[model samples]
Target: MANITLFAQAIGRLPKECIRKIIREEKTDKHSKGYDTWSQFISMMFCQFSGCDSVRDISNGLNSANGNLNHLGICRAPSKSTVAYQNAKRDSGVFRRIFYALLAHFGQQAVWQRTRYRFKMPIKLLDSSTITLTMSLYEWAHYTTRKGGGEDAYIA
Candidate 1:
């Protein structure tokens, strides 16, 4: 039997070749001395998985899992300053592209075939609600008033 962390099992399903191709095309690692694009991507994924609130949290979390870094394909945990510098300087488009690529890949999985609906298209459900705010309390809010009353508004 092989010992496999959940993180490794999940990430193992991704097409590494495709991700590497995107990384090469995007040149995300260009001019990076130590913390390269791959390290940045892994660190970001770690932050997402661990629900880290800040760079220091991410650093601490990774440091605690130092022994498992090899399984994550990273040589070592990144420092807070390194993570912050890469985040500030690296092009966000690379990550965006990778996200879309992964979405497309996972969207075609066999698990989605068992949908209850006959329609094969993906369905997204959206709901809306409204909250009244006092003009004195929320002076910054500039909601338009209809002749009747407040119907609904999407803040986000």
Candidate 2:
């Protein structure tokens, strides 16, 4: 049996027919180009699953998996520039529709449905970047020992 990576197995289960239907309806690939909407979707999904920090990481990560990309349905991995351009130019609504379509296909409710309570104050997010910098170059940086808050509770 051929070995399939967990990422491939996970993405393989997505409703490709539903995705294609939405893509056709949206006309996301109206322009003639090698880098199409499907490729862009796969690239973005890879970025999310792999915790990629940037387009370069996504491109390099996919390129490194050259032999295995066929399982993801693309003929080849996209370049950094292609991925970046698609990310900037593509209509975001297409992706949003795809997300909703998949959620419905899997019989799952919208993400917002899981939140049972609303906070009086707006939520703020902090990014603790995965990238490391030299302490000498970034003297203002400080590390926090706080643990991530548990679910169903708010942290002040």
lDDT of 2 by residue, 1-119 (tens): 98887789878889899999999999999993878888899898889889999999999999999988887888898988899888988999999999988878766644545657889
lDDT, residue 9, model 1 = 83
List the candidates' TM-scores in order. 0.67, 0.68
What lDDT score belongs to each candidate, Candidate 1 first?
Answer: 0.81, 0.82
Give per-model CA RMSD. Answer: 8.4, 11.5
Tens digits of per-residue lDDT for model 1, 65-103: 899887767788999999999999999999899999988
Error of 1 at 120 (Å): 29
RMSD, model 2, all Cα superposed?
A: 11.5
Clashes of 1: 0
